[model samples]
Structure formats: structure tokens, C-alpha cells
Target: MLRSLDVLLLIFLLVTAIGVVCTKDLLGAAIIFSAYSFTMAIVWQQLGAPDLALTEAAVGAGVTTVLFLIAISRTVRREDE
Candidate 1:
């Protein structure tokens, strides 16, 4: 069950990462990146590194996502043609 959960989390991380890279909208990409970071935090937790998982969640998902959202709010949401 644990291994299966890990696999599922990893798959979500991969899909979110790909979505982040493939997204055309900057805001959407930022959102997906945040999801990727959150999924990574879960993976770290499942791997038995609680400290790393907390740090990843706080910094990678929380702080980084906030920063990205702030930047996105100040700029255009879409790429210029």
C-alpha cells in the first residue's frame, strides 16, 4: 500500500511538472508548478524524510508558490505574441 501510494504521488509529480512546462499561460504554469512542489513534498514524506518533507512543503510549495503568484499578479498572465 505504501509503495503504491509513493508511485501514485510520483506519477502526479511528473504530470504536474509536464503541465507546468507545457502550459502557455504564465499563471496556469505557476499553479501547476505549485502542485508539482506539493506532490514532491508528499513523495519526500513517503520516503521517510519528514524533515525534508516539511522544508519542501514550506519553502518549495508555500513560499515559492506565493512568490510566483505575486510575480504573476504584477505581470501579464499570457505570453505576448
Candidate 2:
């Protein structure tokens, strides 16, 4: 069961990473990147690294997402303009 969950989480992380890379919209890509981080945290937890999982969740998912969102907000312009 644990191994299967790990495999699923790995697949989810990979798919989200691809989505982040393939997306043209900056905001959408940023969100996908965050989801990738969340998936990674789940994987780590399944691997019995709770501390590492918490760190990944906080830094990878929280801080990274905030930074990407800030970047998108600063660089993106109105599509109408």
C-alpha cells in the first residue's frame, strides 16, 4: 500500500511538473509548480521522512509558490492592453 501510494505521488509530481513546463500562462504554471511541491511533500512523507516532508511543504510549496506568484503579478500585463 505504501509503495503504491509513493508511485502514485511520483506520477502526480511528474505530471504537475510537466504542466508547469508546458503551460503558457505564467500564473497557471506557477500554481502547477506549487502542486508539484505538494506532491513531493506527500512522497517524502510516504518515504518516512516527516521532517523533510514538512520542510518541503513549507519551503518548496509555500515560499516557492509565493515567489512565483509575486513574479507573475509583477511581470504579467492585461491581455486587453
Candidate 3:
């Protein structure tokens, strides 16, 4: 049962990864990247690495995504100009 869930998480991770890669908008990509982090956290927990999973949940889902958004905001521009 647990292993099955892990497989699901991995699948979700892959889908989110493709979303991140295929997206042309920086903001959209950053949002999907956060989803990637969440799926990764689940995979880590399934692998019996609670510490690493929590780290991913915190940093990957939280800090890293925020940083990516901020960086994108700074470097990317809107077409309204």
C-alpha cells in the first residue's frame, strides 16, 4: 500500500516536472515548481527519510519556491509595456 503511494507521488512529481519545463511563463513555472517540491517530499517520506522529507517540504515547497518567484519577478517583465 505504501509503495503504491510512493509510485503515485513519483508520477505526480514527473507530471509537475514536465509542467515546470514546458511552461513559458516564469510565474506559472515557479508555481508548478512548488508542486514538484511537495511531490518530492512525499517520495522522501515514503523512502523512510523523514528528516529529508521535512527538509524538502520546508525548503523546496517553501523557501526555494519563494526565492524562485522573487528572482523571476526581478528578472522577468510583463508584455503590457
Candidate 4:
């Protein structure tokens, strides 16, 4: 059912959001954040906003994730140093 799917997506979104916050590794956090963004895009689609969903998928999940990963790759963690 659509309602069940919406609930599942919401639950996944919550889990990913918490994963992003609780993750200690920068790379892992970025990955989780991307998942969160992707779930948000699905939610937008379910809400009948395809344009916003497309933008969120492209910018939020795609571009921002890549940028975060690039920034993470260039930086050295204090623990590593």
C-alpha cells in the first residue's frame, strides 16, 4: 500500500538522519547523508512534486554528496594526524 510505503520511507529517512549524525567517520557520514537526501527525494515524489524531487535527487543526493566526499578526501582527520 502507498501508506505503508510512505511510512517505510519515513522510517528510513529517520534512520539515515541518525546515521549521519552518529557516524564518526567523515566518509561514512557523507554516504549516509546522501541516503537521507535520496529518501527525501522519494518523499517529495510521493507528495506530488516531481520537480522538487528531481532537484533534490540531482543536487542534494548527487552533487552535494560528491562535494562532501571530495572535501572529506582532501582533509586529514585529527585522529589521522
Q: List pairs with backbone clashes in candidate 4.
A: none
The global C-alpha lDDT for each of the candidates, from Candidate 1 onward, is 0.89, 0.86, 0.87, 0.91
Off by over 4 Å in 2: 77-81
lDDT of 3: 0.87
User: What digit string (tens of lDDT, one per residue) describes model 3 on residues 1-81?
Assistant: 567777888889899999988888878889999999988998998899999999999999999999988888888833232
Give candidate 3's root-mean-square deviation (CA, Å).
Answer: 2.9
Q: Against the true structure, candidate 2 has what lDDT?
A: 0.86
What's the count of clashing pairs in each model shown? 0, 0, 0, 0
Candidate 2 structure, TM-score to reference? 0.88
Worst 10 residues of 2 by lDDT: 72-81
TM-score of each: 0.89, 0.88, 0.87, 0.89
Show the lowest summed lDDT stretch of 10 residues, model 3: 72-81
Ranking by lDDT: 4, 1, 3, 2
Candidate 3, residue 25: CA error in Å?
0.9
- Model 1 regions lying over 4 Å from their true place: none
RMSD for each model, in Å, please?
Answer: 1.8, 3.0, 2.9, 2.3
> On residues 12-77, what C-alpha lDDT tens digit does candidate 4 reach at each position?
999999998888887888989999999999999998999999999999999999999888889953
- Give the Cα error of residue 52 in candidate 4, in Å: 0.7
Q: Select the stronger candidate by TM-score from 3 and 4.
A: 4
